[model samples]
Target: MPNLKIEESNSLISKAVIMTGEAPSAEAVPVSTTRTGQMMWKDTFYAGEPDIEAVFDVDTEAIQLYQSQASIKYGSIAAGYSVLYAAFLAMGLYGIASVCLVIAFVFGVLTRLTCKRATAAFNTGGIHMAITSSCVRYDQEKPMVSTAIAVQDITTCTVEQRELKPYCGLFGTNKTINLIHLRVANGSSSKRYVGVKDPRNFARLVMTIKNRPRSAAPPVASSEIVFR
Candidate 1:
């Protein structure tokens, strides 16, 4: 019998494996970072999700500011009435003091309700935001408000640092807060995400993922012909 030799084509087999596995690599996988923040009623005030893919906690300062503002607004109104009631009581006007007390009680109840609403907005910490390829979603328990907005719908995303002066710069220290403003396309309305750490980086990451070009199908491998 004539001598014969058989050889395996390793190159061809390896190439086939590489091609099939290469498709996943062609698709750009999103990178995500977790952020923590306090939840405001406005933050989790919306509903519905656009298929969430990632989640980030609301910034702590944002939630704190929101609660503080709510407290101030309702507290001040309640306090004003309370002061009036105290004054009337001190003047020994029984009938007028009774009326003022009723008024103060009403205002105090309203303030308490407002604070409860704020608390119900989220749990102890803050709201958790879900980030998808196209939109971002804000959700929380208790109040059950979830909001989703597409990236393309976003017209403007800005980070602003504002100095907060207490007592009109009289005797208190000033603080700065970072706020992220996102405006909807072709609309005058905008949403603000505040106290986000490294707001610029977060904004850039969102925009980069949003603007990234959609990947096309992977190319099929072709064999080259060789002759000796």
Candidate 2:
């Protein structure tokens, strides 16, 4: 005979247990290898059905590319300011030369800080993305950020790839970096999911959900339903 036990949280069912009357003989009990906090398929079902989910690690190449671009833009501005500073100094305009020099130093420092922060962010576990019939959700574990966007609000999904040249002595080869960019109906408002695996497939999944016909049945509240 076995007794059934139920676990509840806030008066809501969370888990159940079955206790046998007789203790299991030595070697009869099964060994379990599952770890706590590790994500399973069921964890992604928190929102519900017709959902496409993916977990990705940070894309180093993409981060590098972004940093490089930022550096180039800021570096160019700084270089221009530096030239102006020198010209002003030669023209005996001490006040303007000092101002230009200060501007150049600020831009140079900003470029370094931008790249450093970007690198730190990626070092944290990448991201988890889920796209459902009604919305798209994404969250990052470290730094703890989350966002949910209604599918209907999404206007565009695009995948872009760029070649990156890394310096490895004299024989280094170039690598390609892929990025998925999304746009909303609101002007100049957009979001990007970077360093994702199979970005094209993810984009297609979003498009399909966005274009999906509305269901006639009333929407079920996520909390009320239990997924087995």
Per-residue C-alpha lDDT of model 2 across residues 1-228, encoded as one tens digit per residue: 232222212321211111222344542322112222121221232333334333223465666555666677787889999999999999999999999999999999988865663554465444456665467777655555688888667666666665666542123576666666678668496686655544554554455444444569543222111111
Per-prediction tally of clashes: 9, 0
The candidate scoring highest on lDDT is 2
User: How displaced is residue 2 in candidate 2, in Å?
Assistant: 66
Per-prediction TM-score to the true structure, in the order listed: 0.49, 0.53
Q: Which candidate ranks first by TM-score, i.e. highest?
A: 2
- Which residue pairs show backbone clashes in model 1? 36-58, 36-59, 37-58, 37-59, 37-60, 38-59, 38-60, 46-146, 47-146
Off by over 4 Å in 2: 1-52, 56-58, 82-113, 121-129, 138-148, 168-171, 215-228
lDDT, candidate 2, equals 0.55
For model 1, residues 101-147, the per-residue Cα lDDT tens digits are 78777777877755654575446544555556677665656566567
- For each candidate, the alpha-carbon lDDT, in order, equals 0.52, 0.55
